[model samples]
Target: MGNQPETHPNPTIDPKSGFNSETRTFQSLRPKTPLPPLSQPLSVTDYTLSLIPSTSLSATAMIDSDTDTHLSYSVFIRQIKSLSSSLKSLFPSLSKGHVALIISPSSLHVPVLYFSLLSLGVVVAPANPLSTHSELTHHVQLTKPVIAFATSSTSTHIPNLKFGTVLIDSPQFISMLNNFNNSEPPRVEVAQSDVAAILFSSGTTGRVKGVELTHRNFIALTGGFYYTNLMLGNLDEKESNKVSLFTPPLFHVFGFFMMVWTIAFGETLVLMKRFDFEGMLKLVEKYRIDSIPVSPPLVVLLAKSELVNKYDVSSLKIVGCGGAPLGKEVGESFAARFPNVIIEQVT
Candidate 1:
């Protein structure tokens, strides 16, 4: 007689809930109740401050991958308060209605400046330092920033104004960081609906348009991420500290959100002053970068470049690619080359 195949029992079904093996679709595992959102208006800075851990290893300490410089959370927050207080004293007219233009590459001071300005109810408009004077002039007109913040090199790009540009790297700015007399800045009421940032769009199709993002918008965005990571069981995992590398400009939406996301998740961020493909591989080896936020073009490089084989990128476990469409074949090739790494394509 021919060998008989082993017989298996039918899968169990919960008749009361109308769920069975034959069911093609079902209700969400989560309850149908609406998720609670922040009741009161909250600023993005305030929201991030609430998420900061009472004590953490690297969460508070942001390391600059290039310069090997670090800014601990305590010092970062203190500087924010001091800078806010000093800015208020120097330019009392700089209030909720005013905007400050920041033109510089990613640096330790950027976050300090951003948090301080936002907490004081001042709108932050960060623009690409590489933008032409004509392009910047248009942005300046659109944002109408009361004051400007730039590096020594980029400060020349900013045109003459009522309140001129403050060089972030100068000794003067350094003194602002040490102004601890006003330990805590005067509380400024920043509503959730108030404009938090005026981010410019990538001018690929036409002249860039400024998009206004509000505090409420960021609150909900951060909340959604928190809920997602919680459900995925990542937030509670007892794993080695994760380090992430950002090759994109922080001024762009993708880079901007990732920076804030890293802060929320307590991950150490490794910033590249500018994106260079070869330099990125070296950073991964040096910093032991565990994950990277990449665009489609970068994914293509990973799939085809022999240079990846030269680097010891064994520590990398995640590659998040977005900003454009990626092909199925490219994904398959990347997966075949590095089976240990998970490639998440964000559309």
Candidate 2:
């Protein structure tokens, strides 16, 4: 007889856990997200810019909750382009592969600067604005940044660098944002593998370490959130009007990545310079905020704080908790309180 066809039974998978018994692993149930070609020369800035809807250009991109200032998407993109040109002209020494340290509180300007720097292929190394002199020095040493960006209050902590420091709150920096006469800055060819940002660890175990993230790393991260939301039917027409309040520090991974995702999805982001329980509640009511990315502590506060009752937070639809594990009790308490709201825990 000819060779008999091999016979095998299909592997059993747990529907609830998505576990493959034969493979001894948990399989992903979500559809795979498509990323750009690895060989393509694309920066995270370009990738994110491409995803923004042209129709939303005139929409509000960000709002400073502290100052009640609003920045439109049209103005935001213009500033990025203008600032990119100004930076190149003012500091001819700055170029691709150079690192720039950014130490400032969250504001409208920080996001614009981030996109501009990434487009130039400059590695953004943002540290806490409240970092001690010694800590700042350690970071400077690690990244060897050519220039530093700081606010007047935090610039003193920055050490001397190759190009000195530019205060983000200074008039000169503001002028840079308005330099419309300058032609568009020459684009740099950035590889997916090129180091884009040097983020630091939380320093829980030991000294804080700089973590290098590449352009592709951020592209994939943003793409995952974008495509997943699309697949889950979460990007409906109403989703475009969703407003998000970010209470986390911009330097942290949670806030940093979410900022990127928020821009790519063209959502209005409200930034709080500092976190205050009552202040956060008030902003939610004022802005009609429907989404917030938070930590466990904030989750607990939302679940237990009576201050939440004082404000009209009925608009809140999603609360994303990260940075640590959310206790079952805490999760249940939050769910019980806001039965209609979704509490998404991100590792």
Candidate 3:
């Protein structure tokens, strides 16, 4: 009776997840850009085109570290149009719903090819250049690509394609990019729901499955992220010359989305044809890369590697780690090492 004198009130438990919950769906206080109607004829390329300022002649769109090539926004757009024209001329039957299987390393022409294909309502199916013959065959059969865009090194892996292969590194393809034509390619109306790209999964859990990301999906996804950044005052430094080094494979979602995001936000991208730990450090020093989008493993490397100490990485202001969860200890170690750099871990 004496022990029962001090009884406490029982806490209510949540029905789901077996714990008391404070999580609630809340509306954002910040206003966002009105999304276009579902019926709107919009392509991601066109959306990206709209982001380019008409007077932005001097803004560098991308830099090719392999060739030391630089393309400004105006030049980049012009190249897209020219390449679209060339693609149309070469494969007259290439139409909406046609797939272009791309197997090439990161290069100056990758972005141009992607934008050009999407502009014409073509579905881009980019794959890893290092994929084996059987893996390549599986991808080819899955996508049923009408045309293939590959390099000389990777083109041998492509089976007999319907429209043949275009070697991205070949002089013929380079010629197409340089040639200016008066006749514009006929405009193809692409709906917002239309499939833009068939990005593949890591195949870690199972066989690789092609993920069909649509125009509206990209629009909504990117728009929300960008708007949130705008709300956070991240866009206030719009005039500052921002540069980012991308270490992930462009075929993967993280790298693919980063490429699109970098372009949309007008940041100069420094692409490495291949990732090498020491090479990455050198590139960071050379380009004065202000930020980098890295995976979790790279985060641990950054935390533990003595290689980072040898490079002049003072310009690096942000280290964005994503695609996997980073441990608290690893993050803490990274923070301790690079106090000046902001380490943002995104799920």
Candidate 4:
């Protein structure tokens, strides 16, 4: 949290402005402002927006592609500010507890959309794009979301999901972005125990059951390990970190929290929709990537992929693995392939 300003002012600040008779001039002063925590009733989405006027710190979400990028840290937060401008008006009659589902490929849109839902004191259920039609429909039906924002990447799959999926990358979405305002949305009061996210353990443990990770759980993960920079140490050259090549799916908890939130730390995440041995290696070498958070299965491919030896991956410092166990032999193979890359497990 080095630059993550621990203190913020109040959200509702009313300054008194009146003519000072003694001084014979107009005077005004504002009291201590609301410093709401990102997960608080106001949500970090709004907190992120408040920082935009200060400087341009980026929180980029790359849904793949080198140029098709949106929002760095500050910019990302600002974009969130823009998106939240029409919250209640967008869904006037819905309860504050009802969620707004976001299924987009634009990395910029994901955090703001999700956090905006959370800020309203609603629960979030992220459906994986790779999930089958039945799987996607099951989660949708199970949760019964009120509003949804989805990308065309898998539009055909949820053709009849009984929800309005705001096409964020389409002409309509562009118009929405262009016409969006910066006014804050109606904030809701949330408790620490409120469910911030619902994560499912990978099928390794059989059918996935939604693991209700509350706001407290999210705070601990970020405040405890991730924000401490356990994975990005290798990314640092002298004093700053390097851009990371992200090949994991955004829906996976490993990618969503671990990689997605890494943006606020002033790091770049280069996303690849899905892992391709050759393609991933090319990007790593191309970007001179500093860090990567991946799975064990993919690690094996990264270890054995001809691209490892075919190109330069010397820039890589650490490989963070989650969602499964990596065998000693496989770990050794990965170590042998990239001696500079340290492997860490979160199982």
Ordering by TM-score: 2, 3, 1, 4
> Which one wins on lDDT?
2
Cα lDDT for residue 82, candidate 1? 94
State the lDDT of candidate 4 residue by residue for 4-65, as single tens digits.
Answer: 32332433332344445555665434222333455444333333333222222533444345
Residue-level error in angstroms, candidate 3, position 228: 1.8
Clashing pairs in 1: none
RMSD in Å for model 4: 12.9
The deviation in Å at residue 183 for candidate 3 is 2.4
lDDT of each: 0.80, 0.90, 0.83, 0.61
- Candidate 1 or 4, higher lDDT? 1
Better of 1 and 2 by lDDT: 2
Any runs in candidate 1 off by more than 4 Å, and if so which? 1-39, 57-60
lDDT (10s digit) by residue, model 2, range 4-115:
2222234476665667798898776555678999999999999998888676788899999988999999899999999999999999879999999999999999999999
Q: Comparing 2 and 4 by TM-score, which wins? A: 2
Q: Tens-digit lDDT track for model 1 on 1-347?
A: 11222232435444334345566533333322223344675678878766655544334357787789977767777888899989888887788958899999998888789889999889989999898899899999999998999999888779876678999999999999878777578789888879999999988889989999988777766766765666567676366557888887888878787777777676778888888998899999998889999997898898889999889899899998878877888889989988999999754
Residue 249 in candidate 2, Cα distance off native in Å: 0.9
Rank by lDDT, highest first. Answer: 2, 3, 1, 4
Q: 263 in model 2: Cα distance from truth in Å?
A: 0.4
Model 3 TM-score, 2 decimals: 0.89
